[model samples]
Every structure is written in structure tokens, then in C-alpha cells.
Target chain A: MKDWKGKNLIFIGGGIAMPPIRCAIWYALENRADYGNITIVYGARTVGDLVFVDELDQWAQKERTSVIQCVDPGGETPEWKHEIGLIPHVIERSNIPAENSVALVVGPPIMIRFTLPVLDKMGMAKKDIYTSLENRMKCGIGKCGRCNCGPVYVCKEGPIFSFEQLSQLPSDY
Target chain B: MSDVIAKDDLLRLVDQWLAEGKRVLGPVKAGDGVILYAPLAASSQLVLEGFVHAANSIKEAVFPRSETIYTYKFNGHEIELSDVDPDSTQCIVIGARPCDAASLPVLDHLFNWDYKDKFYNARRAATTVVTVACSEYDDNCFCTSVGLGPAAEQGSDAMLLKAPDGWYEVRAVTDKGTALFNGKTTPAPEIKVPISDGPAKKFDTVDIETFLKNNYESDAWRDITMRCLGCGACAYNCPTCHCFDIVDEGDAAGGRRVKNWDSCQFGQFTVHASGHNPRAVQAQRQRQRIQHKFRIYPEKFGAILCTGCGTCTRNCPVSLGVLNTLEAIAAVARGSIEVK
Candidate 1:
């Protein structure tokens, strides 16, 4: 793993994936010295679809952190200044430096499917890119036997995985 | 303290337990071809022959299919909640198959993981399962492959092996098992534990587990796919499959919460309120069923989830048997089948 103290923590996500990555943001803030620059690149289909509105505003001002919020290109308003488009294009415009850094993407399947390759294209190693998965689960624990991604149970093994780890999983989701 | 008893004496033991004011449950012929573990009103209702297994497992006696978790009532200005207590029910499961009895301990590990499921645990505490060795075996039986046999006694309180004669060779496997028959037995001929010749021990599942772990995109899955009617019979009839859904029933302000049996085969199973469905296709749903039983579960808990009872195959509308799929996967792992 890259050194979080000097490396950038880039969060590229949207929709329901907001809260969990936001959780990581709060966590990094709790231990500011161990982490470097934290950038959150969030998007939604529309403006109202955004979540944790006040927290986003709060993190926007926090030191060593940057918050980039966007909606679909068509969702742009007259007052909006931030680039509005698909998250990957907007992230490409941000000129993110992938060296010695890790990128976390938490979003719908389409967002994950599109965003991860873009990071890969930008020279992010398979190990440095991570994503969260969603599945139907009867038991939050490993019991009721649903929430499986191939041989791995999403409930127990993970709802989280690195790009390299996910490549080894069956594409059931 | 001799432990073996004749069939007549076993029936008498049931009669005695009933006389002692305890509920006795056993597999009874439910219909023309159906058999179920039901509460026995008379000793004659107990059907110990035909090792083809019952229509249901002994799980429902403890974890019922559909049960009201709690009730809520309208009090003048506000609604009140009432939690159901699990200390009242007492039951004895008679004539459980070794596989059926074994599923309880598997369920026990799950229900008591981090947060104890009080209702299941309470009923588990109150119930004593009595498993009987098989007198026969069918083509679909595979209890031996998953590390259990007709006489394997992992979860039985008391195990009774049927001798060539009408009597059963009894042995206690636990403290509760010993308590089931303390002074009720007579000295009899010593017998070896009987093993079922069903579920030929030839089908090795080790390679299948490893293959599934390494190859997520194995074409073996497509080969096993048949035209499924999407009915939940496989999960519904399975002894080890216990997925459930919590639903609110009754009127507003005075409704009760219920736990209903759920199946992963349903399209609505993985759908989100935000209109996102992860497993939107039938193949994904079907894959989950196999992975849960053979792969995900064993890797995490070190116990094969499927008891190889063949209930899923017997209940499948499309004749998509689990054993065939497993064998095919094993073949793929062995390099017998070329990956496409």
C-alpha cells in the first residue's frame, strides 16, 4: 500500500455510494497526520440527488481536503461553475496525479465499471483502485447463505474489494 | 444400563413422552407421495421406513417458515410494541435423518454468531432431535459425500441404528442424548454403525470448491443452466437453505412484523429502493445458490452448506440437479473439460 501520509486519497463516487466514502473522509480527518491530500469527486443524476449536503460543505473547507461535486452534464444550472458531466470525464478534467496514491470508487455498477478503467488508463495499479459492491442479503452475517459473488459471500467476505481482488471474483453482480 | 431397544419399545417411548405431556414430532406420510415432519397425535402416525427423507426438514420445528416476530397495538395516542418470548415451546424431533439433524448445529453456529437470534436459539434449546439410521436409499441420496452418512451422529441427541431385526441399536451422542433414554432400555446385541450406500462416495467436492474460488468465469455455469421455471421449490424444500425476509403485516398502527421464507431465485431479491438491481438476470441468481452452498459458506465457516440431501434436485421443476452441476464443475477443475 502507498504511504497515506504523502499520497493522495482520491474518492470518485456518486449516488448511494456517497455515505460510505464520506465515512472514509471523516476517518481520515480523525487522523490527519497519517493521511495526505483527500479529494472527494462526487456526482449524481441531479442536484437534489446529492447526499450529506452539510457534510460536503464542511469537508470543502477542511485542510488537506478537497470536495468536487457535480451532476450529469444536462443537470447544470446557471450558477454552477464546476464541470458537469459523467464522473470519469470530470475526474479526467481534474488532472488527478495517480502516483503514490489510492483511488476509491463507490457508486452504482455503471459508475464502477466506467471509473475503474479510466483510473487504470491513467496508470493506477490494480491494487490501488478499490470499490464497494451491493448484493441482496438475507442475513447480514454469513448464515442465510445469500449475498454471494461467486465463491465469496458479499456479506462476509466483503462488500469491499480492490480492483485486483474483484478481478478474481465471478462477475455475478 | 443397556441402550438398544426394539421398534415396539421405541414406540412405547414415544407414548411415554406423550403421556409425560411433551410434544412429539415425526415424519409422517402427508399425502399420496409426500412425507413431512409433523406433530404426531398418535404413535401410528410415525413413519420410520423409506429413507427417502421427508418433504420438510426438522428446521421448521425450531425456525418456523412464517412466524410473527412481534405485535404492535394502537394505544389511545401512540402505538406500542410487544416482543415475542421464546421460552415456552418444547418439542422433540423424532426420526430425523443424519443430514437433517446435522443442519441444526450448522444453524446454531450462524444464529449465535455475533448477535444471538433469541427465537431460534430458544427453540433450539427446547428441542431434542432423535435421528434414525436409514433402512433404504434412493438414487438422489448423497449424504455420504458431504461428510455425513445415514448413521453419522453430528447433531442427534440420540442416534438409533436399525438392525437387520426390528430393533434399533441406541447410543447417546450428547448430554441431552443420554437423558432421552436412561432407564428405558434393555441389554441387546452389539451392532456396528450402519452407513448408507446412497450418494456414492465417488463425487469429490474438494476440486469444485477450489475451481469456483479460482475461476469466476468458468463456462461450467452455462453448461449447468437449464430452463428454470423460477419456482422456489429448491430452496423451499432444502433442509439447509434458510434465507428469510422480514415483512410488516396487518393494518397501520396495529400491525405485526413477520419473518417469511425468501428465495434468491426471485428477481426482486436484489433490487434496491433506488431502482438498482445487482443480480438482474436468472443466471446470476442461480449462480448465487450454488456459490452459497459450495463455495462462499465453506470458505468462511469451514462447513459445507449443502447436506447433499438432494431435496433441491428432487424439487427442481427443470430437473436441474445439484449433483450434476457439481460434477461438471469438478470435471472442469480436473481439466477434463476444456474451458471455452
Candidate 2:
């Protein structure tokens, strides 16, 4: 993230995956001048499933920040002002600029699986797309040995990995 | 010329160490015809022969099956926590197999890799390993395949090789060894203990590694490991399988947080709280054990996690140890077996 100065920072998060994405957005917005633009495409099963609703509105009010909220089809209510579709389809229709941008995606496996191709088609480099992973972990250090994806132990090496880094590992996790 | 110690003198030395309060661990005959590496209550309890290998490795010297890391006590709206002191008893592990001794160095990397484990390091510092060179090996022994041998001095402080007529040739490889046996050996220039060439190379490590690197999705994993009962006997008995679980065994009153040995072969080893399991099936778990020992650990720590001890196979209920799996992988790499 530090290497890509002035690059557009795009955050895509699904239900209950907002904490990490929310963290990155807060840091980027805290130093808004250091980045080019900030875009948050957040979705859940329904509006009731969304979190930090007021904070999302607050972030949308900030300069150069755009917050897009959505829900799955048929999950929206009568007053639903946002889009209605799966996260990947909504992202495709959002015209999110992939050039000179780093995307941080967080969600369940299904959300990640469908969103990657959309980001790729939008011209996001694999190295620029990051996601955090979770595995059964006991000792947060590397010794316990259960959290490994391949040669790397997620506890010590990372829970956050770029698509480029993750692609090299066996799909064990 | 070799420094020789009579078998009687060696047993006496063990008695002397026990009298001096140093913990002496060696292979002992447990009931039911099982020989295990256990703490010696007396020198007479040590079993010197008739066992190909102890049922357990000497890993318990540094990494015990279960240990308390810390304790907690609940106070009025507060909690009091106390750290457990790691056992620092001056310890000597005598009569360890060369394969068992070699696991120490391999394990050292994991304990000290980035976050230094104080407990493991403290015990390791206090323990000195005395290995006995194997004059005999069984079909399960494959130390040679993994670049180790019967008399390999990788982690032994001192080594004992069988000599003529109830004597052992003492070879001290470290200062610790020299100090322990400083005045215990008699010089016998004419005696040379013949060492057995360890078990024949069972599988090529390079070929096995190559196959593992390429065959993550192969159907061979399912076929090869179909009979694995997931009993985890192989892991529990393995010298280098160091996975563990940390649990807090307490309620509102407070209790201790302990670390216990865990096994990859267990179905719950990699299950997430959300009920998503990465390596969901038995085959995947078996593949993980092999890949971890051969490829992943070596790639990360520059050492193979296995010493080719073969205890896993010897203890495995289904006869599906790493050797059998690796041999199958080797055949697959050589194109002798086809996987759809």
C-alpha cells in the first residue's frame, strides 16, 4: 500500500467482512491528500445486514470519497435507495476505474471468487488486488503449523496477501 | 584409536547422574513388550538392546505432550495472571537413536524462526543428547533416504557405537559431550566399532519433492491415503510433528492456559469457526502431512521436517506411513502409476 502513492484505493467488502476494509478506508481517508481517490463498494444480504451505516454516510460526505452500498436481489425494501444485485455484478456496473488503482477485497470465498475476474476485466493487476485470509489458528506464531497455505504460515507471514502471492500457493486454504 | 566405555561403566555413569539430580532419560522397557524413551528412575531401568526403536521419540525432552504456559486467577472485577516458569532442570537424554537426535536441530528452526519460544529454547539449552549408533535397522528405517544415517552426529552432544565384548566407543561431538565423558572413557587404540550402513534409501527426496510440488490436485492423494484411519498415531509418535493447540482450561474462577500436542491428521485440525474446512477430507490431511514435512518446511526453514525415523509407519494402524506415501509419490513421479 505504501508503494502505490497517489493510486486510487478501492475497497470491496461483503457481509461481515467490513472490519479490514473499513480499517484501510479510515487510514486512507485520515490522510486523504496522500491518495488520489477512495471508493468503497460494500454489500450484504440486506440493508439490515449492513454495518457502520452512519460511518458510511460520514465517509461519503468526505471529499474525493464515494461509498456505494448494495444488497442482494429481492433483499431491498421499499425505501432502498441503493443498487440491488450480487457484489460482483454491482461492481461490474459501478465502472470502478482499475487503472493505477489498488483494490482491497474482503468477503466470503464465493464473493472473492466472483469478484476477482470482474477486477481483472476492469484492468486491476493481480499484485494490486489484496485480500485477507483466515484459517484455523491456535498459536498466532508460526510454530503451531496449522495456518499454512503453502510454505508461508499466515500467522507470521500474513493473513493479508495479494492475488499474485496467493496464486503461487497450492489451493489448500 | 577410540575412547571406549564398558557397558557396566556407562550404566554406573547413569546412576551417578541420577544421584546428582540431573534428569536422565533413556529407552526403557515398558510393559506389553513396548520400549519407550522415558525418564530413568534407576540405571537398572534403561534398556540397551533388543529394540529397533523406542515407541516414542525423545522430543518430549524439549516439547512435552502437554505443558502449562500460564495461569489466571479471577479477582473482584480484575484478573491476576502469572507466567509459568519453563523447566530448567539440567537434563541428559541417553541412548537416543540418531534419527531421534537429528530432530532437535530440525525443531530448533521452528522454535526460534522469528518469534523465539522461551519454553522450548530453555529446555533445549538444559538438555544434552547422547545418541546410540544403530547396529541394527528394520524395513521401516530410512534415515539414509533423508540424508541421515545410523551414526549421524547432527544433533548429538556425544554418540555411543557398539564395540567388542560389552563396550561402546564414545565419540564426543561437542564440549558438552566431552565434559560429560571427560574421565569416563579408557583409550583403546586397537578397537574400531563397525557401524551399520543405515536402512537402504527407500525413496528419492528430490523426486518426492518434485512430485509434491506438482501434484497438489492429483487423484493419487485420495487413492494412496484411502485407508488412513485418521487415528493420528503416526503424528503422535513422530519425532518432528510439532503442531500444538493452546487452550485455556478455566471457567469464571480462572485456570491455566496450556499447550497440547496436536496432529494434522485430525479432522478438526484445520476447521474454521465458520465451519469452513480447507483440507476437508482425509486424503487432503494426509497430503498436507507429506507436503509439510518434505516441501513446505524445507522451503521455509531450509531443513526437512522428517529425519526418516519411521516411527510413524511403525506405529501407524493402517500401515500408511510417510514412507509408503512417498514411495507411491515417487512411482507417480517416475510415471509407473497413473492417476486419472
Candidate 3:
């Protein structure tokens, strides 16, 4: 993220996967001058399931930042003004710019699976899209030998990887 | 000229080390016609010959099967953690096979790779390995396959080869070995101990590695490893299988965090809390073991994770050790066998 100065940072997260995305947003916002426009597209199954409600409102009002919050089709309430759809579908409807933009995505496996092709179709290069992986890690180092996708240990080499890097690994995880 | 020590003298040296309060481990004839590396109480308990390889590797000297890393105690509002001192008693491993000795250096890379394991490092530093070169081998022995042989010395502080007339030709490899045998050996320029040309190369490691890299999704894994019972006997007996698990054992009051030897062959090894298992089947687990040893470890650490000791094959319940598996893989690679 530090390497991509003056580039737009798009964060897409789904239910319970907001922590890492939140962290990256904090980093980008703290160093506001270092990055270009920041966009956050976060969603949950229902309005009650959504996290950081106050923070989302606070971020939306910040200069050069936009927050798009949503819920599943039946999950919206009467007072809800945000979008209504699955996270991937919501991201598709958002019409996010892919040029000179990096996407950081975090979500459940199904959400990630559906969201990846959406970003790809939006003209985002595989290298510009990143995600975190989790495996049954024991040692948290490479020695325990359980957490690996081919030669790469998710604990050691990465819990974070670019889509391009993930493509090179076997789908063991 | 080669330094020689009589068999009697070597046993006497073992006694001397034991008397000096050093932990001495060597091969002994355990009951039921089994040979294992165990702590020697006296020199007479040491079994110098009559086995190709011990049932277990000498790895327990440094990495025990289970060890307490730290103990935690809980108070009303605070917790107290106590660190266990890694045993640093001066230790000697006598009569270890060359394959067993070689695993030490291979393991050294892992214990110190990124986060230096203080427990492993401390014990490793205090231990000295004395290897006995192979004079005989059985069908299961394949040290030659992986670029190691009968007398190949990689991690031995000193190596002892069987010489004629009840004497051992001692080759001091490190300063510790030299110091141990200082003024104890008699120079014998006339005698030479003959070493065996280890097991024939079963399969090329490069070919195995290439096949592993290219054929991740092949049906050959399921076909070749169908009979593997997932017993993990192979991993337990392997000289270089270093996978382990860390667990906190106790109630709410708190207990000790322990590291225990783990195997990739186990079904629960890679199961996530969410009930998803990546390597879900026995074939996938078998493939993981081979890939880790042949391709992954070598690529990451620049050293293969196998010593080709054949201990896994020798100890496997079914006949499917690494050698058999690799042979099948070689057959697959050559198109001699087809997986439908």
C-alpha cells in the first residue's frame, strides 16, 4: 500500500471481515496526503450485523473519502437509505473505477469468490487486487508444516497475497 | 593413516561419559526383537551392530516428542507465566546411523530459520553426535537415492567405521569429535574399514520434484496412495519429519503450553475451526507429505526434508513408504502406469 502513492484505494469487506479492511483504511486515512481518493464498500447480511456504524458515517463525511454501506435484499429496514443486494452485486452496481486503483477485499469464502470476478471484470489487474487467506495454522511459522498451498505457507510467506500471486499456488487451501 | 579404537575401548568411553553425568544415548535391543535409540544407563546396554537403522531417529535428543514450552498460572486479575529452561546437559549420541546424523543439520535450518527456537538451539548446542557408518543394509535402505550414502558425513561430529580385528576406524569431523577422542585413538596406517555402496538410486529427486510441481491435480495421487491407511507410522519413524503441534493443556486455572510431534498424515492436521479441511482425503495428505519433503522444503530451505533413510518404509504398516510412493510416481511420470 505504501508503494502505491497517488493511487485510489478501494476497500471491499463483508460481514465480520472488516477488521483488516478497517486497518488498511486507518492507515490510508492517517496518511491522507499520500493516497488519492479512498472508497469503502462494506456490507453485511442485515443492518444489525453491520459493524462500525458510527465510524462509517464519520468516514463518509471526511474529505476525499466515500463509504457505501449495504445489506442483503431482505435485510434492509424501513429507515434504511443505503443499497440492497449481495456484496458482489453491490460492488458491480457501484461502478468503481479500475484505472490507477487498488482493491483490498476481505470477506467470507463465498463472498470473496463472487467478488474476485467482479473486480476482474471491472478491469482491475490481478496484481492490483489483494486478499488475505486463512488456513489451519499451528506453528504460525513454517516448521509445523500444516498451513501450505503447494510450496507457500500461508502463515510464513503470507496471510496476505495479490490475486496474481494466489493464482500461482495450488488450491490446497 | 586412520585413527582406530578397539570395541572394548569405545564401550569404556561410553561408561566414562555416563559416569561424568553427561546424557548418553545409543541403540539398544528393546524387547520383542526391536532396536531403538534410548538413553544408555551403562556401556553394556549399547548395541553396536546387528541393525541397519534404529526404529526411531535420534531427533528426540534435541526435539522430544512432547515438551512444555511454558506454564501459566491464573490469579484473580493477573496471570503469571513461567519459562521452562531447556535442558542443556552435555549429551552424546553414540552409534547413530549416517542418515540419522544427517537429519540434524537439516533440522538445524528449521529450528533457526526465522524465529530462533531457543529450546531446540540450546539442546542442539550441547549435543554431540557420533555416527556409525553402515556396513550392511537391507531392502528398505535407500540413503544413496537422496545423495547420501553409508559413510556420508553431514552432521556427525565423529564417524566410526567397522574395521577388522575388533577395532573401529574413527574419522573426526568436528573439533568436538577430535576433543572427545583426544589421546584415545591409536593411529593405524595399515588398516582400512570397507564401507558399503548404499542402496541403489530408486528415483531421481529432480524428476519427483518436477512431477510434484506439475501434477498437483492429477488422479495419480488417489490411485497410488489408495492403500495408505493414514496410520502415520511412516512419519513417526522418519528421520526428517519435523511437523509438530502446539497446544495449551489445562483447565481455566491454566496449565502448560506443550509442543508435540504431529504428522501431516493425520486427518485432523489441517482441519479448520469452521470444519473445512483443505487436504480432506488420505490421498491429499499423502501428497502433502511427499510434496513437503521433495519440493517445498527444498525450495524454501535449499535442502530436501528426507534423508532417504527408509525408516518410514521399514516401519509402515502397509507397504507404502516413501520409496514405494516415489516409485509409483516415477512410473506415472514415465507413463508406464495410467491413472483412470
**Leading candidate by TM-score:** 2
| Residue pair clashes in candidate 2 | none
Model 2 RMSD in Å is 1.9
User: Each model's C-alpha lDDT?
Assistant: 0.78, 0.91, 0.91
Model number with the top lDDT: 2
Off by over 4 Å in 3: A29-37, A44-49, A57-86, B251-254
Instruction: Rank candidates, DockQ, best first.
Output: 2, 3, 1
lDDT of 3 at A51: 90
Q: What's the TM-score of each model vs. the native? A: 0.85, 0.95, 0.92
lDDT by residue (A1-173, candidate 3, tens digit) is 78878999999999887876898899999999999899999999999999988999999998899999999999999999999999999989897888999999887766776888899999999999998776889889677888898888899889888889988988776
Q: Which ranges of candidate 1 are over 4 A from the true structure?
A: A1-7, A16-38, A47-69, A73-84, A100-104, A123-130, A137-139, A150-173, B72-81, B190-199, B331-340
Off by over 4 Å in 2: A1-4, A73-81
How many Å off is the CA of B186 in candidate 1? 1.6
Residue-level error in angstroms, candidate 3, position B176: 1.3
Name the 10 consecutive residues with the lowest summed lDDT in model 1 chain B: B189-198
Local error of candidate 3 at residue B40 (angstroms): 1.6
lDDT by residue (A117-153, candidate 2, tens digit) is 7898898899999888877789998999899988889
